[model samples]
Target: MNAFAPTRTSWRPRSLRWQVMAAVIAINLCAALAALVVIIANARRATEIEMLSSLAIGARFVQETVERIADEQGGTASLAQLPLHINGLRHVRIRIEDAQGNGIDLAPASHDEADGDADEVPDWFTALITVPPAERDIPVVENGRRIGEVRVAGEASDEIAEVWEDMTSLAVLALIVNIAILAALYLVLGRLLRPLKTLSQGLQELEEGRFDHRLPPPAFRELALLAERFNALGAALRLARDDNRRLNERLVQVQDDERRQIASELHDELGPCLFGLRANLESLERMTAYAPVASAAERVATMVDILDRIQGLNRRLLRRIRPMSLGHVPFAAVIADLVADFEAHSAGRRFDFVSEGLAEHYGDSIEITVFRCVQETVTNALRHGGARHISIELRHDAASGMLKMAVSDDGSGMRANALPGLGLIGIEERIGALGGRWHIGSTDPKGTRIDILIPLPPANVQAESAERTVIQ
Candidate 1:
């Protein structure tokens, strides 16, 4: 019941191209993230493999030097010399321990060496190994017994750190590249789909019963063909619309003509007959005033009154079909007659008719249209609106060649959202037939108001027609 709410038609779309584009961007973004994840995992694996291989090579070299030094006689300095000889390595940490797990030397033997007990390696440094080394009991092999374990080790921390930094940098670069590519793709898609968007809007209009909208020619050949087909379809729909409108107009015109003809026949022919019969009956009643049977005369008088009532009903019916003639009557006279008729029929309800602005300079069709609009509006107000008072105003502007008529009532008015019924529909059709505008329904102060505006014929045209009529 709220006045601000619009009527819900069944033809509107819920989403447009912008929504689709956003969805596309989201899908592309997700795909880019997944691809980036896969690349980062592969890069990490490759880096780990390379680091492991490099460390293994360095460990073998250290082990060979340690075993060679052990082969020499009391050559503890040989294993210490291997640290400076291990070239092409950075931040290398080397450890040499004896059979009793006592450190012979540490490559990082300065104050910055990892904190540890005098003979044990730091827990953090040893934890870097993928697996812990096994312990042994025998000093030399005796029937499957082991002597000692030679541990040669290098740290993969720096290399792993370098690979992680490089991987992060590459991921950022890939994301920037993906974003630029997605933006370019989005623009290209938008440009290509622009014609489809226009076509969709046109179709939406057509679905809403606005069949006049035609799609513009598209850039693509196939789409251009589709646009042409749609244009042709719109043209055909317009033609159908015009045909239907003309058909309805013709039907209305025929009905109006039939009503006028019937009213004319009943009024000009049968009306007189009934009046003559009633007059003859009245004459009989008067002539038999002194009859011998007074009861018979009284019955004849009753029949005479009934005949007069029938004649009156027939006359009212004729007026209902077509108003009283205004052929030789001026505009004011016609309005006065109409107001008198309405007042008489309205059972004491007050009705007023007022006029202003060059009432003498009006056309027949304009005058009739205005009068009928007022008459019908007032009748409806009395019948359904429970109106106590009604006003009819007719105004003309001679300078502008505009004529306006308004009928207003203080009554139970119509709702703003309510549509026209049969009476209002007929009024609109008549006004349209005269090439005028018709407005109907409730006023702001709680009443029905029907305003009509019709353009008057140009003075030159009227003068030319008058000259022709004079020549004829």
Candidate 2:
């Protein structure tokens, strides 16, 4: 009723523990308030009843005393002089008057004094327990003549003091009980929440790639089921990761095997045939130097020139078939050789090459992939796109365990909606099979730029140890 009432809209705590605690306190407070209302109501009623009974007794006492005194004093006793101070002096105030309603002065009515100390309770609590006073009046008579009226105003100071004392004791006991119960609840909640803490730690471990982590079943049925499900999911993820790792390894192995076979075929079969052709052409050109026929000499010279071109082409093809030089020599040397050969053949197109992080050699699979990708992209830029200027950038991000390459050509770029050639398609498949990605940056009239990104296994895990063992 005063300034200490709770807001109509109550606030709630965010944390689970605080939320539960706040809820319990609110419910208990409401119950305590309700009991307080009932006690105050009953106390008010009882006080009014007791006060009325006292006032009735006081009125009768006054009337009888006045009649007795008048009989002894010749029926002329003053109502004020009839021991009026003896009536209603301790509790309620009483006024006496004659038939003409004349006033008879009596003792003063006592003012209310808050009992058991108002400050002991909260403002809201004190306001809630305040009670209205009771008032009554009774008729007084003497010798069959109306003498006066006795008016009573019940002040609840005494009764309220008693109620306040009872409520204060009850409040203290309620507070003690509430605190004990809250402490017990906190202990129980801590034990009950242990399984949740375990679950949280298990989740963090799973995120860190510890898929083998398993949580023990909890005491609660719901938590036990959750643990079981989490274990199952972790098992599934571990299995999937193993399968993916094995699959990528198999693909890399197959790719290397195919390259080895092709290199073997070119060296054993194609190498000898080309050598014999060059020898025959040299012999024919020498005989033409001795022959007198001008036409015959010209024909032989033409054959020699054709043989030289074929030999150059064969050497280039061998470099493509087997980049074994990269295994024995620095990767930069092999790259330099390839660039020189390309520049010799295509004097019209200019090629720009930039490379970093290639000083240390990787496994054969890694080297071959890089060499072939560069070779084919440059060839396409010149042979297919007729590019005049081509730029190639090769960068290895050791920190990220990735290799990045960008090739752009200033050529009449492939027309829109045109299908990519076999060269482009083969590169895409090769990179994808190695778990890498590729993008055709642009294919407009200005130029075509191809971007390639390959994730490398960590340097320590590049399978170079197996290659070293094979060599030994």
Candidate 3:
């Protein structure tokens, strides 16, 4: 199975979405914490106030009842009667003091105590009397002189503790849930944006000389449209490139056509005139064979040599104008002809041709392309390869319909940075036109090789036979 299987939401960036959601949840959690703080603070204050109020009411009832009992007893209450009036109240703790010190009730008396020993009210009781309630104060007066006091205490309650605990637990749970939600969101967002990053990378690749890489469409509608546009632009650029290539080929073809016409005109007109002039000059030489100065014969001989040289130049020019026919010729025989021609033209080099399973006859264009490619290879080997020997090989496979041609030389081959020659360019163009592939490289130690392989054209046995008849 292919990795990155196509899907609708494949473009999502998983990590980024998690980050965004975490941020959102973090904000909510901060707000929640702040609100929880306020609620707890206020609740604590309310609980304290309620407890203090309840304590104050109990204190007030005790104090008023004690004052009423003291008045009914004419401002004197016996120690034994104290318990009767203070009975049934949760607040009452009695301490009766004489002029000297203090004495207490059911609770055990402190050590170092004397009866009626009233130095002053105790410090703890005094402090409780000094501090005021949040809303109001409770006053206890006897004979308009403050001797002792009762005050509210114990503000925290079990019910309020339970409520606060539950609130705390819920806040913590909310925090955990928020973190999970944010993590999920971040993952989703990261997945969404991943394809866009890949697309940007693809564009950079295209810019860096890799025209084949293509950007894919995004999952979402908006990004998908953008992807489609980019793909369309790439397609357009490829078409333009193809068009430019075709136009260049047409230009080369036109130039070749013009050269052919000029060479034909030269051959038809200038060549015959030069030949006729040479014949006339020869006849004149015969006529003046006995009645001529010494310089006349020498001049006639020089003219003949010059004419012969010109004729050779004309033949070379015509050969360049139009390539020689190798279509009807046996493939091996044509290779032999090319080698013989090259050997005759250049010294200090020998040529070799090899044929294995070559076709009886190929189309003119195929033969021409192969021949030109070989010719170019040999020319480069002599002119640039500094070669002592050149080798050409032609092979074909009937089953596979493949033709392979290679030219190698024993020479100082091309350097790494050497620019391709016009001939090499021509070979490449021709192979490209025929949808074939060609490569040039160092063959071995001190040598270059050019290799070409292409699918063979369908054989035309009848056409080959007719051409063989004509030739014969």
Candidate 4:
């Protein structure tokens, strides 16, 4: 396994809005639980107090009735009537018992009769709020002897039931209120965070090299400040990019001017000198052939041959420096001559040149850039790719004011991990400086293909008749 290979990992991102909502829900639930605990505790204390108060009041009423019964001479018989008088009392029960252990028990009335159709309190809640029982006994007497006793006992089920009802109502109301608050918060958060989406789009444009794209100001103060900074940065980047393009264009122009100057010097200064030398060698060869000097004619012929080869080398070097007929002749014809020269030099290789809607000339920069690109790509295809057949296509669309060129070769495709060489880098730099685009990819069945598109000025959009030339 290669250590440099990229590693893949799965990631799941949580949403900020939902995370905030989850935190709110957790806090609310904890608060509600704490409130319930406090309410139940307070309810238990209140129930105990109420039970104790009812027991105290019932004991006082029973003591008074027993004294009255003793005074009226009814004795135990009146004690039985005491239970009837306190039968409907709240939070307490009344009972009467005699010396023989015989007793009358009076239980509290049923809770359902008052709270109709209400749910019964849960056992857990009832246990939490139940108060301890309280009981008091009042003695009954006749003629200074005790006869019977009245019993007053506290009960808290009714009070506990009322507390349960109140708790249920409060819980339902709180649930509804919390749900409404959460809904409102969701909408508010969405509106507040909307500027982030716009920022994301602006970042994508920057990644694609659109340094001139600017972000709009957001309503939020912090986000609006961010947008202002982003716009300023974009402006700075656009200026830097424009400056770089201008610099590259100036460099290319200077280089081309130097090449033209060098080509002119070679043509004017060296062409005649070599011509004169060759003429002298040829005349001396003919003169030696008649005079029959020993080996003089053979040596003269060799010198002539050497001069011819040197002239040929000089001409080829001049063409490579600068094509003399570039701006003077048709652009298609110049390209045709370039392809023909390559085909003539490369044995058993086929070359094709096709032109459609080409103008007489584009600007010097565009023409030279295109020519250099073609030269570099074709050379790379032959030297590195081992290509046998190379095709060049040039098309001009007058309506769009665009020029398109495609160069394809039946050669070994580029390696997947191969970095581009200096030639390709130069081609890209030249094309990018002119606000053009280029793509290189694998062709069908195993080959390399490069496509280029350059925008032309409206004045250079003149259309010429279509032509096709194939060199084998």
TM-score of each: 0.44, 0.47, 0.43, 0.52
Superpose all Cα atoms of candidate 3 onto the true structure and report the RMSD in Å to 1 decimal.
18.1
Each prediction's RMSD to truth: 20.4, 16.4, 18.1, 18.4
In terms of lDDT, the poorest run of 10 residues in model 1 is: 463-472
Better of 2 and 3 by TM-score: 2
The model with the greatest TM-score is: 4
lDDT for each residue of candidate 1 in 1-472, tens digit (9 for 90 to 100): 5543442232234334455566667887797778656755664465456555656765666656555554553533343454454434432344544446766444444414222221243334323322322221212221233333334444444444454556568768977886797688778777778888888888888888788898878778988998999889888888988977976886698688768867786787567667766766776776676756666566576667667666666666655556556546666667767777778767868887776654443666766677677777887899878888888877665555667778898989986677666567768877888888977767768888888887777751232111100000
| Tens-place lDDT digits, model 3, residues 1-472 | 3465553245354445555675687789688979766766666566566556656665666567667766887764344454455444322233444333344343334211322122233443223223233322233344555444333243233325444556658878987887787677667667777877887887887677465667777778987887787778777777877877876886688688768877876787567767766776776667686756665666677667767767766665555554454655676677666677778778767777777766567777788887778777888888887898888877775667767888898889888898876678778878998889988888756798888987776663223322111110
Q: Candidate 1 — which residues are off by over 4 angstroms? A: 1-21, 32-52, 67-77, 87-93, 97-151, 196-213, 220-233, 282-472
Question: Per-residue lDDT of 325-349 in model 2, one digit per residue for the tens?
Answer: 8889866566666766788878776
From the highest lDDT down, the ranking of the candidates is: 4, 2, 3, 1
Clash totals for all candidate models: 0, 0, 28, 0
CA lDDT, candidate 2, residue 152: 59
By summed lDDT, the worst window of 10 consecutive residues in model 2 runs over 463-472
State the lDDT of candidate 4 residue by residue for 178-284, as single tens digits.
Answer: 99999999998898777787888998998899998988888889999999999998898889999778767866876786689677766775676577667767667
Q: What is the C-alpha lDDT of each candidate?
A: 0.63, 0.70, 0.64, 0.81
- The TM-score obtained by model 1 is 0.44
